[model samples]
Target: MGVRITYLCVILCTSCNGIGIGIDLARYPIDSPTSDEYLQMVNRARRSLAETGCASFPGFLTAEATAEAASEAAAKSPSAFVTDSTHNAWQLPDDDPARPPDDVRNVRMRTRVASTAYDELDEGGALKRLYQYDEFVQFVGAVTSQPRLYRLADPLGACSINVFRPGWHHAWHFDESEFTTTLSLQQAERGGEFEFTPPLRRSQAELAEPAVARILNERSPYRVSCVVADAGGDATAPPVTTAPFAPGTLQIFAGRYSLHHVKRVADDATRERLVAVMCFATEPGKVNSAEVQQMFWGREIDRLHVSPMSMRANRLVRSVFLMLLMISVATVVTAEEAAAEPVPEAKSEAAGEAAAAEASPAAEASPEPELPPLDCKTHELLEKVDTWSIDCVAMWLANLGFPELRTAFTGNKMDGVALKSLTMEKLAEDYGVSEEDQRKKIYYNLKDVLRKDNAAGNTNHYSQMFFWLLPLLGIYKYLTLRYEKQIEKAMKKYKKWQDARNPPAPVEIKTFDDGTNEWTRGLNRDVNLGPKKTKAEKDEEKKAKKIKTPKAE
Candidate 1:
């Protein structure tokens, strides 16, 4: 029994050693450096990174490992989503003219990138195996001098391989992570150098015009070199440096503090740049938002990964609700016009009596042609309301007897689409309509105007679909605004000329007992009261007018 137990113990020990033997740690040291050698190697790397915000070790991976890793990456490259897109560093506000046409903020970047999510790789792949190694993780912690380091908990973003084909590049952007470590598997034949400006911006306020302009328009002196080494051997010897494209090298960078970009690969280059990236977080369970995931990976990994609502999505929702509101308003206007038509005068009693007295039996038997239903002009004037203006919003609120809310809305330049996103709580918070009843009143009033059903509670899927369609409404609004000014000018001129020629009679103005207008009528009311006049009626009217006019004498 003792002999058998000893053999089993030996077998277990050998299996454990075998499990650890795959990662060749000779080129990449896994053991902590000794005290005497520490200052020359570890301390030097730490100091270089602390001062310059970037450090790299050359020939960290053997040629065979690099070739193997490159093979694995190349095999997966065909599945990467290659996308070309344009974006400015700063998001330009809608119709903001304050930003100069030639401002660096206005510059749009064009880049093509092929990137795959880490979850797509095989479990035993080279990249996955290297990242999962405990010794490798400890070695990284020691080199960076970070007290504790954790592999990213995010499944898709933990490890990724980036492939830069000819003419592909990564545009300048601040990284979301603090530290990024990359292993160069293969280098482009030409022009795919990594360039960066260290300590560019610490916060949004620091991303000022002059600072960005200096980096973009002027030659900056703070550009960091990709390759850096510690001085070794003779004291007088300069630390060897190489371009960032050197394969088999490992690079560690403080990407959060540095604004960096990969230079475009040469248009004629035959080789591709393959890089394996491993991202670490100081804390565990750190994950990126769904928008960032979609932007980088072309698709989200999970359906339940909800991100906090973004302004762009809000804009889309508001735009869609505004479109529905426009349709509702149009329906209300048509109904009001139908109701406002004047009642036609019956034939004069005296004329009817005389005609009866002189008429033949056949004339008396003939019936009068049915008077056509009163012709109501289509109400296109509702489009004139400038939803972005405070006065216009005030006019709308005033109709609801909440004129005091105008002060709250003053200086608000949000368009109609944006206003459609307002909730009762937000309305109460902003306008001091703190009373629950008052808030409910305001919400109901707006709801009646904006929606036909006035359904209370959470929005359904149909409502979500409507919000998605709101961008189409935005496009229509843009096109309409472009022509609205010209139309308003023409209408003003026509009104002036008509007033001058007509010299109107005095008329009594009637006021409603209740402060109610056509809009107060619910959208459920019938809007199609009667058919509009056909072209035949217009032609007959012109002929009758000509016949009634006296001849020139």
Candidate 2:
């Protein structure tokens, strides 16, 4: 009975955490990276992605888990934000009226899909669990060949559920992200297919404008492949080939260069098509802009306008709540142990006092402990600072008695480079660091980290000088180049004006008494005839030439 009760408690605790339960570990084995099966799975997905710009796993989630996720999405469907707008293949507004009608930029299509934003997901929901699962993230990174990947920290775009009700669809468009990961929880009764053309752009340096236009204009039937999550047959004309994807399948697609869209569900479809998009980035601190959040999620997250004090207070409340929950769990376990084997009253009292002492807040002590001095020299710290992780920074901040700033720092995904750039103003304005003294504490400590390094005759001093000097040098070079261009232009214009103002003298033809002709050009040359010839003389020469010609004949 005791063992059964203990097992029941474990199950309850596991369910409450909701971390790994959503995934099918036995089938996928993403957590076991060293296993041969894991390597095979990764390699297979990589090959598929390389060939078709997408990869799929048919049973990424268990059937039960898929049902649970579908149910959750269905419940939230009413609250989902619906969007019905016409957009171009680039997903930009048709703001450039000068663009030609045949250009892909001007070719517009309609999208009418509803979305459940990241914030709308429940903390322990199956979709959320899969999205936050470290193993799943790692697997995706492996498939995409990313050495490291971080989940998007955006309040809205991070992980969203996309709903395609009957007669609704997503238009042909390229994704802004390099890669997109999605899991299908449910499929419509009919028609809602995912159709895509292979990557049109060869690389980031060049845009395949003509090919994209072809796809956007519905002229690339041979290149189109219709992927139906529940259907097995592929088609052409509308879609070239059809592929099957069962519900619970996970797909990672390189959609940045591929033109793809979800086909409209049939008007008579019995069920809605539901898919969850899990967003990740190569770099941390990835958040959507306010405009994007508003456009998609129907609201905006004004991080700059938020109050730091209030955020800290909220953090404290959550921390206290979690602490209380832990304490309750511990009390229950302690009671169970006591019932299993009783202790003397005095011993129990003493044990309770020790536990209380350990659990008590440090603020209750006579006075809080002072922050420890840095153990490493400035130069040494500088040498290894580049390798420091976010958690390392958090611990350092905690030691400095500024644990409240951890959320702000982590939310921005600050690294050593970002830390070096942080200023008191940025802290106060962007991060809501309103308290003057707290700002000084953080800003000065960070400055000291570098200042001491410079004072200690480290390479950082020279590097810092070089960095400061670089921009000035660039500005000087740019100004010099610009000035040279202007001077050259001015000189060319002056030469042209001089040439146009002083026209060359016309050539003069002179006839001499000997009948020799001389040509004088401008004022530079003088070809002297023996004597000047009058018009009467010219007539005499003409008569002479005529007489000579008659005599020769």
In candidate 1 the C-alpha lDDT for residue 551 amounts to: 89
lDDT of 1 by residue, 1-553 (tens): 0111111111112222113434445544453232245336667667767766677877767667677778988998999877677545443333235665555555666667887778777656667777876556766777778766888876667888888999898776556777888988888888778876555546544443444454554332222211113223222311222236577787887777666678889999998888988988787677655555666677665533422333455566655655555454211112433324334569999998997899888865886665333222222213322233444455556557775675566546434445666677677776678777677676766655555333332344467567546645765875577689887999999999999999799865554456444443332245753334579998999999999997899
Task: Enumerate residue pairs that collide in model 1.
Answer: none
Q: Candidate 2 lDDT, tens digit per residue, 1-553? A: 1221111112223332222566777788886675689999999989988777788888888889999999999999999998887766666654456654645556566779899987778877888777876667888899999987888878678899999999998877777677889888899989788877666665544455555544554642223221212132322222222335569898898878667888879999989999998888888777766655766777776533323544676666655543444344312232321112123256687888987787757646656555343223223334434545565565557657776777777788876666777877798888887887787788767766665554452256577678546545655655566599887889999999988898678877886675555542323245545355689999999999897786645
TM-scores of all predicted structures: 0.45, 0.52
- Please provide the root mean square deviation of candidate 2 (C-alpha atoms, Å): 23.1
lDDT of 1: 0.62
Question: Whose lDDT is greatest here?
Answer: 2
Output the lDDT of residue 381, model 1: 15
The 0-to-1 C-alpha lDDT of every candidate, in the order given, reads: 0.62, 0.69
